[model samples]
Target chain A: MRKLVFGVSAFAGLLLACTAHAQEITVGFVTSLSGPASSIGINYEKGMNAAYAYKDEVSGVKIKLIKLDDGSDPSQATKNARKLVEQDKVDVMIGTSSAPGTNAMMTIANELKVPFFAVSPVNVPIPADGHPWGVSMVQTPQLMVKVIADRMQRDGVKSVGFIGFSDSWGDLVYNGAKAAEANGGPKVLTNERYARTDTSVTAQALKVVAAKPEGFLNGGSATQAALPLLELRKLGFKGPFFGTPSLLNRDFVRIGGKAADGTQVSAGPVVVTSQLPNDHFAKKIGTAFHESFKKVNGGEADDGFSGYAFDGWVVFLEAAKVALTKAKPGTQEFRQALMDAIYANKNVAGTHAIYNFTPKSYFGVDERSLVVVKLADGKWVYQP
Target chain B: MNAQIAAILAIDGIASGAIYVLIAIGFVLIFAVTRIIFVPFGDITAFTALTLASLENKQMPGTVGMVAVLAVMATLMEVFSLWRKGALGKIPAALFFYLALPLIPAAIAWATAGTLLPTPLRLLLTVAVILPIAPLLNRIVYQPIADATVLLLLIVSVALHFAMSGLGLLFFGPEGVRTQSLVDFTTFIAGTPVSGQAMLILGSAIFFSFLLYLFFNFTLYGKALHATAINRTGARLMGIRPQQACTIAFLLGSVLAAVSGILIAPVNTIFYDSGFLIGLKSFVGAIIGGMVSFPVTAIGSMFVGILEGFAAFLSSPFKDVIVFSILIPVLLWRSYTLVHAEEEDEE
Candidate 1:
């Protein structure tokens, strides 16, 4: 009789909850899922997306996420961002694997008055000087480059040749190195510029070798950077070589062979999984995200750009949950409340790492969490 | 600053010039016989070098000669088909000709990737990959432009360059192969240390020139080729088959591009776009040497190469300015003489 009574009460509760239709919530994400930059964007997007679905349900609210391919072109990023806002009517936006595209999308978000979250945030201070609506999911180039530079300096590399990709991203890393000069570090022996499409880096490598620099720090995508690695090895250049996060890929191990062993790359050293193997709170939420997202997307989970997408959705849900208390609050009130909540938000350990965005500190996170990773054997096995 | 320094610089130029000379020879040969240059010649060179490097990296067991032989045979087969179709006659010929040339470069690059080739044999293999392309070009783009002199040839050359550049960017993806040095480049001569690769390149250049000279002089085929170069219509009248000579010249031209590319692979990186600059410089060298004459441009290529080395070494940033310096004065002089002579040609 007691069990029967409890079943009837549960049925009545379900009936009561079905009284009114729930408002639709939308989240939009854009990233480079194709092109030469796929090495970074593809893996990143997969990881983030997996992180999103690891939830059973997003904060007691129904969720819908729409993803668009940005193609790694900055101009295309703007158009894609606008479509998500104007046509899709998304409540939030996240994107762009690389900086240029993401920056363009961030600018669009400013005009549209939409909240934007970034995946690959740099160590450079941007969102700090003025932008409040944006936050980075990954460590900045300044931090990442410094990690590699620190390692090289520790290795006693006195003179170095800096080979940079001829693009905005390349420029970003180069600027980071120049800033490090103030510390009175290694004397930069030479600087070489190579077009992104230059495959036969032997010529560029030859010129650098002629300078006889003891070390090389490359800033570019994997293939472009890999060519130089191959050239250096053939010329018997056994000196230490380092790269930005762009060169960090397991495929680099397969293609680069033994030559890749000593090669190092710097990243936020993200330790993302469906669940942290040990952290109890992380395991519970990660399990939910894994199961729900897999149910929706029909695959296993990964902490790719989708993680940002999910994170964007989570931020929105939390804000909406807080905002819902206003019973149809004004957009300003809701936005301000959300911003306050973001400021006060704490201990949000994410696959991309925990978010701690405050008003005054737009970055809201320590840059030192970044670490230098080396390729040992064939994987991104961390070096001490 | 001193005599020895100057001599060393000269030697550097000769070594550098040797690679360019071989590439220039193809440009000169095709220009002379078909009277229109093969614009995709550089792409062909990049294709071969990239393949050889990939092959070398794999440490696959093979002689570079075997690889070269396989490539030449395959290319020659295509040349015959183009010849049969008379694709060398006009637009259809050029269209068909361009289609056939890429197959060989692509094949060599794909098949031989990771194969270790002996250095001398590797150079030979490189020569093999490009050597057969000239004859094919004769039957395609070059021969069609034989009668074209003004905007027509220029348009054709530019168009071919763009197409080849695109395809080169596609197949090679702007990346070139990295080959190990067959000869040690780091060594000392007398009291001074000279780059060993530099000496090897110079030596290769001398050997290539001698081979080129012997090729132009003694062979029956060579005599017939010279006859056609002197007068195509007359050669046709004498049953020398001007068509055959043009095709042969194109083949010979392509071989040099391959040879030079493979030879340079061990010393420096060969890029997909390397051909355009080399092609341009070589064309300049040919013009400086005199278009109709053979050895003049080959010898002139060395002088141009030396100047480039000086330019590159002097200030890497201004290498382009230094190399083109020679071209500007030569052009102005030629134009001055041309306006006075009621010139029949720009060169």
Candidate 2:
């Protein structure tokens, strides 16, 4: 009778332990680990791993991360998101490298009613009710391009020529330039487009050179972005060049060689972390992220894409901490609570920017989150 | 646009057209002799450029490892086929041709990868390292089904292209590389400045085309390849081996692709997967030629290049659409002009 009584008590204790351990949260992360975008995707994975190494628990709740590769394909990204939500049963989702892929994943997030954090600068469509299930960790193209436009105005540039990919990204940058133009930015002279895999942008450069704009704005990303700049320089267009954060990569510097010099780009604060003031909001967290990144990845985070992923993880953690107080994980109630907490986040300092998210505004940064950087001597120099 | 801009655009178009001509000729040559479309021709060019870039960076190219693996696989398959046919006496020669010959360049690349070799030597090494790739790929992919229909071969060729692309990503990584220009001078061409690199591309294209003309008209082996391309059975009855003809075609194709890669690496940022679009564009040129006439293919490629330049300038977003749409009218004309031959299922 005593043995039976002890067994029942131990069984009760095991049941209590199981309920206590139910606080664990699962996060589904999808990104492009292979394909053309794998270069950025690998960096995203590295930053996410670093963030995980930095902190894996929130208020005694352990977090489990399930990573999926989309191979930079939008359909694959959507399929991965669905699998993550249905099979992995994640509490919240984070992912994807490219804008299209992230937007594809966003639709799945919306349909599944799961909280999502997009690492790429995807233009999220908010419903008429002013509510969105997903938020972008990276700044919008308009926000980043505005800084370049402002700098161009300050530099007394009257006209600028635009060359970008013949895709949605190009449209995004062109739209941003047009928006900035209404607010005293330089008049955009020409909008030339080229494919990412195009061998030459000679014709586009020639058109841009013929326009004889005082400055040039490249909307292409990665190594391809350097093509128009190189061709423009060859054509003797000695105007200043401007780009967005996508050009903040070693390949751009290396491939562009001498032509990349004097090119200015708008990037997140994490790019110039060391150059920031000591008391800056992003400095403390940015430095910690760098340290943790080097400790985990064995190298400095050379591009802004990684910091975007790290910031996404940090934002997710902040919301998870709050959501854990409301309901057990893996439940619809917990996902709702998590979504609310993400929307309620205020002044959440991350490696890239200080995010202030709300239901209506999915892009959580403003002008203060950006800084102009110049490429000089194969290095990114902070511009004051 | 002014005359100067037009001239500049024309120069740019001719330079890129020259590259397409080389690649299109390669596609036609391989398809004629092997009955395989050889979709990986552009991949071979991309690999050569990547190999040269690795040499320039003083790093061991993944080509050495890739070639070694391919050589072993080709040798094993050759030995198995020879054994099945009871032609055991040909094993030594097969080993030498399929294994040792290919590995020699790979071994040289491996040995000299760390040293600061001269530019010409590096170019030669890059060409040599890539020389066996197409042939060995032939042995692995197309040899077993040598008598398959053209459509089947084309399907296999496309699958091979995707496989090569995946393997390229594994070997070269995702970063793009542009090699130093072989010649670094600009000269005025009718009031428009043209780079020396563009001249080199044009010169090489003309030189190779002339050389191909000479070989086909004057050489016995080249005649044998031409005969095999005309009628495989008749050429075999005339004592020309079709497999030998196919191998020679692939070698010549590889040389053209290698030369094109060398000429293009300085001008364009070459990536692991950049070859697909380049190859596809050239294929469009080949299709315009009805995949038969060499001179027509070259002209078609030049037209494609010039049209691309104009299209890009006129409507930047519709450039690719315009370029690819040329196929419809050309195909319609070909279908109207030519009599359809019933494709026979080969044994």
Candidate 3:
């Protein structure tokens, strides 16, 4: 009877150990699922999901994703972050597609000490003092602007006009351009701003036309970015138009149509993965994610939005692997471990960019990762 | 700003204001005859633009499906009412009026869509398809609630606006579309170059308003409409059908909305919800006219447009604030200048 009891107790102990090791690693996602910004959110979500499906399990632990919609409101996004940390007890957090929402989420991530990955381009500067427990999936605005400015300088364009949203995005792009201008790039002659949902930018377009710059830089994204270009074309401006990396999408080209032709935007390496040099760190991973995205998304070509999510997972997995070695999943120690792992990791390449997050630089990209492409015949032609 | 800049801004303002005037007129007509504020004015405008885009692409529009469904419901309601009243002789007429009338254009649109038809014919058919939606919407939504107070009707109109805008999102997706320009010539005016389409919008808005003035002044049908607008019960006692007058007003309002939409589509990108802001600006102008005088509404809306243009040049971010702030002073001036009188209580 004593021998039988010993065997049963040992078996029960083994079962408990297995269960502890098998506990799932949870990732919380908060983004705009139903609002004006839903297009960006939906595209990001699809890309993240495709990457998630491609490899769901990591380190023998099932990855559990708990997604929430913030309706694109900044307040709602903060609430979402609180819920993800306090209620869901997520090991890591990702998303809130727009800049404002992402900024809010970063604060919460810092307070809660959970590693956060932003799945879309954010305009607000991340806290540079330490690991704000956050890393951006997008190329930094400075890198994007530098690409455009460098091209303009090389092409001998002297003067440029600016039109953008009256938000932080506009400030960031303008600041980036100004930074580049200090380095002998195109001189910005005029500046104009409009709301994201505005139907007309005629006044701004007229002002841009009056300036008659050699080129124009529209600092909005998607259809919102397309409006100023459309108006400028209608007003017969006929100048080379430059845009941010955010404007590199199918909808931008499709909605803007003929007016969009000859327009240039800075793009991530994933946009033209095939055209990337073999030695480029982002090339192989970009091509792999591109193929996976196309297979899952009804043959849709991979863009930077999807590339962000795919690359975000790579960052997450890399950090998680290191975090798991130090502490078990579902613990505060594990969250802290994940953040430290991300902060310490250097030159870990995925798609979009060769991410090299450090204590001070969390955006993890520079001019090396960005390329300038012009929209011609509705296709992105690489300018090398 | 230079003379050239001022001229350009003025033309842009005038073109945009022309579209706003159409929306204001629609609000006045529908409110005058039917006591409904017509909140979906912008949604219908967006639908008209999207329908033309679909026709241009040679695809049967999502609008035809909406027409089919609404027509059936309207027909069934008309038939049921006639049968319950034992007015069997009137059933066929109701079917012909409600169902057959809308279907003819639907058939033409479906047949000619994606075909090699002349652009003018396709555009005409696009207008035809959009024209009947307002009246049918009136027949189904407004006629049932015709006896409701203006406030209640306004609420229903708001609800309809939300529904139509949502439907627009489903039909057109997130991308904004700009239709082909109706005219391509660029004319130099006052040393400032202006596109032919901009000229077309300003010219047609004025010409149509003149035509509307003539229609109201000279025709017997116009007299009946004016009578209905002046007093619904009094016109009914004089052997005029208020329902017929309501349909006519709605038809005219809808056509104006569609024409303005087509005109503005080339100037700016038209999204699913773009109409709401335009419609609201026009509402402000309509209020400036006390929703009574067409000429006053046109002038008010044009002023609103010009102010918006100047404000945009000065501070594009504050343009909306400036345009909307004008309404406060206009309302205050009118309230103080005009005599306060209580509206007659309806039975």
The most accurate candidate by DockQ is: 2
Candidate 1 local lDDT, B1-347, one digit each (tens): 35544555566667767776776777777666666656666666666676566566663212233234433554455566668877765545444444445455445544666666566665555555555554544444555446666467767878978766655554454344456666665676664546677776667667777876787799988878887776667777888987778777777776676666666665544555666766677677777766655677778788788776555444444566667788879778877765332213532
Q: Estimate the overall C-alpha local distance difference test score of candidate 3.
A: 0.84
Alpha-carbon RMSD to native, per candidate: 8.2, 2.9, 4.2
lDDT of each: 0.62, 0.89, 0.84
Docking class of 1: incorrect
Q: Top TM-score: which candidate number?
A: 2
Model 3 agreement with the true structure over B1-347: per-residue lDDT tens digits: 98778888888889888888888988998888888999999888888888888887788877898888889989998899889999999998999999999989998887876775577887788789888889999998999888888789989999999988877787667677777888989987767888898789989898888878888899988889999998888999998899999999999998898888888877777778888888998998898988888888999999888888888988887889999999999999889987744543685
Q: For residues B170-224, write the lDDT of model 2, one tens digit per residue.
A: 8988888999999999999677899999999999999998999999889999899
Task: Write down the C-alpha DockQ for each prediction.
Answer: 0.09, 0.65, 0.47
| Candidate number of the best lDDT | 2
- Model 3, A101-209: lDDT tens digits are 8888888887778888987555455565545788888877778888988999899999999998888778888888888899989999876888765656889988888
Reference-based TM-score of each model: 0.69, 0.92, 0.86
Question: How good is model 3 by TM-score?
Answer: 0.86
Q: Which of the two candidates, 2 or 3, achieves a greater TM-score against the reference?
A: 2
lDDT of 1: 0.62
RMSD of 1: 8.2
Candidate 2 chain A — worst ten consecutive residues by lDDT sum?
A122-131
Q: What TM-score does chain B alone reach in each candidate, compared with the true chain B?
A: 0.77, 0.98, 0.97
